[model samples]
Target: MAITDAGVMYGLLAVGAGLATGLAGIGAGVGEQGIGAAVVGVVAEEPGFLGKGLFLMLLPETLIIFGLAVSLILMFAWTPFAAFMQ
Candidate 1:
């Protein structure tokens, strides 16, 4: 069967969703790299600072979570996709 307009639109939406999640994960990884190294150095010097270092390291993870949320919204809740579904 030939591809319809809706199919093309849905494919683009899927690509957008994938990009959102992938880019967010990449950004988080890049952000965590620097913080991870610093955290390692701090924990090496002061074992007592481990908790604080861990908290700081985890902060970058929120970016990934936000990206996931956006992708979910795009796939399931965006008005165009919702309309296309009906």
Candidate 2:
């Protein structure tokens, strides 16, 4: 009895990739949402601080970008278990 490995490794990798992206997006979304809300609140009180608010709002986006880069690298460039399974 031989196990068909055609989809096993690929499926696992896909699931992992999905999880990585989902978690990263969730975290980034929450962080950026909070930042944006805070910036809005600050701006409401002091319209002159627009530059500072914009900077604060954008800072959390770096995490999402980094996560996307890591996911892309994992999906395309490297797969440790793929070698072992094959």
Total backbone collisions for each predicted model:
0, 0
For model 2, where is the 10-residue window of minimal lDDT?
A: 77-86
Cα RMSD for candidate 1? 3.0
lDDT of 2 by residue, 3-81 (tens): 4585676676677777777788888889999889888998999999899899888777777777777677667767565
Please, what is the TM-score per model? 0.89, 0.74
Clashing pairs in 2: none
Per-residue accuracy of model 1 over 1-86 as CA lDDT, tens digit each: 66668999899899999999999999999999999999999999999999999999989999999889999999999998999988
At residue 10, candidate 2 shows an lDDT of: 67
For model 2, how many clashes? Answer: 0
Best by TM-score: 1
Please give the CA lDDT of all the candidate structures.
0.94, 0.76
lDDT of 1: 0.94
